[model samples]
Target: MSIIVDDDTRLVVQGLTGSEGRFHGLRNRAYGTNLIAGVTPGKGGQDVEGVPVLNTVAEAVSAHGANTAMIFVPAPFAADAVYEAVDAGIATVICITEGVPAHDMLRIHTYVHNLGVTLIGPNCPGALSPGKANVGIIPAEIFTAGNIGLVSRSGTLTYQIGHELTQMGLGNSTIVGIGGDPVVGSSFVDILAKFQADPETEYIVMVGEIGGDEEEKAAAFIEAELTKPVVAYIAGFTAPPGKTMGHAGAIISGSSGTAAAKKAALEAKGIRVGTTPTETAEIVAGIARG
Candidate 1:
C-alpha cells in the first residue's frame, strides 16, 4: 500500500493552461492518475486533451470531485493557490512551482497544519507511489512497486537513489520528494511517520542533505518511535562551511548542519548511514536479501 497517493487520486491541475502545468499534468494523466479537471482562471470553458478546464479550484472540487490539487502556477501566486485549494476542501495539494518566497511558505506551512491539509511543496519534485499514482514532476519510468519506503529533501537525489534501488531489483512502496527549500510543507519526520504506520513498507530509505537540523530531528523520532530498519544517505559531505550548496536549505553554518553531524546522529540511533547514494541502496539491498 502507498502512503499518500494511490489509484484513488482524482487530480486537478491548478495552472493547466500554462506550459509547465500542461506538460506535467498530461504526463501524470498518462501515468494513470485520475486527471479529472484543470483550473486556469479565465481560461475556463476550454479543455486540455479532453480534461475539462474550470475557473476555480472550488469549481473543480464541486464539478469533478477533485480531492487532490497539483499546482504549476508562478512562485508569487503559489501560496494563494494553496489557500484556495485548502479553502475549497481539497485534501491534498502538491505545489511544483519553485522560488516561492520563504516568508510565503512559512505562512503556508502553518496554515496547512492548522487546517490539517497535506501540502507537498512550493519548490518540490512531489511524491510518487510506483504503479499506483504519480502526482508531481517525478519521472515515472524509474520506479517499481515494492515495500521499501523512501523520502528525501532533494528531488534529483531522490530520483538517483530510486533508480539505484530499482536497478538492484529493490522496488519502493512510495518515494516522497519533500523539497529542499528553506521552508516546505512536509518534513522528513512527517513522511516517516506515515511509512512507519504503513504495513506494506517493510524497510525505509531516508535521503537528507547538509542543511537544517531536520535530519537530527528525524533521528530523534526514529529512536523513539520507528521499529522498522532504516538506511539513510545524507548529501553534501564535501560542501564547505558557511557556503550554500545546491539547495537553499543545504548550507552549513559552523558545524550544526554538516553531513557528518547528521550521519553521526542517525548512526547513533542504530540507523545505517550510507556514504553515497549507491552505497545506500546496497545497504538496503543487503537487508532485504537477508
Candidate 2:
C-alpha cells in the first residue's frame, strides 16, 4: 500500500488555472488520480478540464472534500499556497514549485510540522504511488506498482532510479521526491517510517545528494526503526567543497555534509550504500529477489 496517496486521495490543484497546473492536473486526473477541485484566485467560477475552480483552499476542502493539495503556484507565492493548504486542513500538500525563498519555506515548514500536516516540497517534483495516483509531476510510465518504496532529494535522480527499478522488473509501491530545498517539510526519516509501516513495501531505495546532514540522520533512523532493507546512493561524491551543487540545499559547508560522510553513516547502520544509481538499483533488486 502507498503511504500518502492512493485511489481515495481526492486532490485539489492550488494553481489549477496556470500553465503547469493545467497540464499536470489533467495528466494526474487522466492517470486515475482523484483530482476533484481546482483553486485559483479570480478564476473561481471557471473550470479546467471540467474540474471546478475555487478561489480559496478552504472552499475546495469545504466543497469537494479535498484532502490532498498539489501546489503549482509561482515560487514567490508558493509558501503562501502551502500555508493556505495547511490552514485549510489539507492532510497532504505537495508543492512542486521551485525557487521559493528559504525564509518563506522555513516558516511554512514549522507551521506544517506543528499542525501535524504532511508537506512534500516547495521545490520538488512531487510523489506518486504507482498504479494508484500521481500527485506531482513524476512521469507515470516509468514506474509500476510492486513492493519497493523510493524516497529521493533530487527529481531527476528519482526518475532515473525509478527507471532502473522498472528495468530490473522491480516495481515501486511509492516514489517521493522530497525536494532538495534546505528546509523541506518532510525528510528521509519521515518517509522511511511510512514505508516501514506499509505492508506492500518490502525493500526500499533512498537517493540522497551532497550538502546536508539529512542523509546521516536517516541512517540513524534506519538503524533504530526500519525493519525493511534499504539501499541508498548519495549524489555528488566528487563535488568540490564549499560550493553549491545542483540542489538548493546541496552545499558542503564543512566536512559534515559531504557524500563520503553520508555514505559512512548509512554503511554503519548495516544499510547498503551504492556508489552509483544503477548499482543501487541492482542491490535493491537482489535484496528483493531474496
Candidate 3:
C-alpha cells in the first residue's frame, strides 16, 4: 500500500544516457524497480546495460507502457522534459535535477495540476516504497517494508530519520522526499492526504524545515483530517532570520517561518515534535512500541 510508486511502476529515465542518469537509473533498476525504458535524444535505439533507450518520452510510453518518468537532465532542460513526460501520458514524473529556475517550476506546477498529473521534484531525492519500488535517489538499503509512512522536505534529513527508524526495527510503507524547492510539485498536505488514506500505513513521520507556511498548513491538515499518529521533526531551529539555509525554500522571514513557530503550531495540534532526527525516531519507536 505505497503511494506514488509500487511493484506496478514501469519507469522511463529521461536522461538515461548521461552519467548521473545512467548511474542512478541503473541503481534504481538494481534495487528492483521495473526500469522498462530510457529516453535520450540523438541516442535512440541504444541501451544502458540492456534497458532500451528511446529518443523521446512518447516513444517510451507508446512502446513500453512506461507510466512513470524520472528526469535526471540538467536544470536548463528539466522543465521541458517534464512537459514532454506529461504530454506523453506519463502518470508520474520525478525530477531529481536541482537548480531549476523557480519561474519554470511555477509554470510546470500549474501545468501538471491542470492536467491531473503527479510531479515529485525538481531538487528532490525521490520516493521509495521499500521492497516494492525505488523512484528517485533515496538509498534503498536503509529501508524495510512496514507500516510507517514518511514525508520530508529535506532529502538528507529524510535519510537520517529513515536510518534511525530502521535501526529501531521500524519499517516504512513509503518515504517521499517532496524536495525543498519553494515551488515544489507536492506539498506536505498532499502527501499527508495520501498517507492518511493508504490502508497499510499505520504511522507517519513528517520532517519539515524552517520555511514558508508549509509546516503550519500541514499541522492544520493533520488536526482536521489525518487519523494516524504523526511524529514530526523541524530543521533550521537556529537559522537566522532573513537568510536562506540549505534549501532555497528554507529561509526565515522575521519569525513567520521559524522552527519554533512551526513546532508550536504542530504541538498545538497534538502532534509530537522532535528536536532532532534521532529523537524524532525515538518518539515514533515509543509510540509504535506502546
Compare the candidates by lDDT and give the number of the best one.
3
Give me candidate 3's TM-score against the actual structure: 0.98
What 10-residue stretch in candidate 3 is worst by lDDT?
246-255
How high is each candidate's TM-score? 0.98, 0.98, 0.98
Residue-by-residue lDDT tens digits, candidate 1, 18-43: 99999999999999988999999998
Tens-place lDDT digits, model 2, residues 175-204? 999998898989999999999999999888
lDDT of each: 0.91, 0.90, 0.94
How well does model 1 score by local distance difference test?
A: 0.91
**Which pairs clash in model 3?**
none
User: Backbone clashes per model, in order?
Assistant: 0, 0, 0
lDDT of 1 at 113: 96
Ranking by lDDT: 3, 1, 2
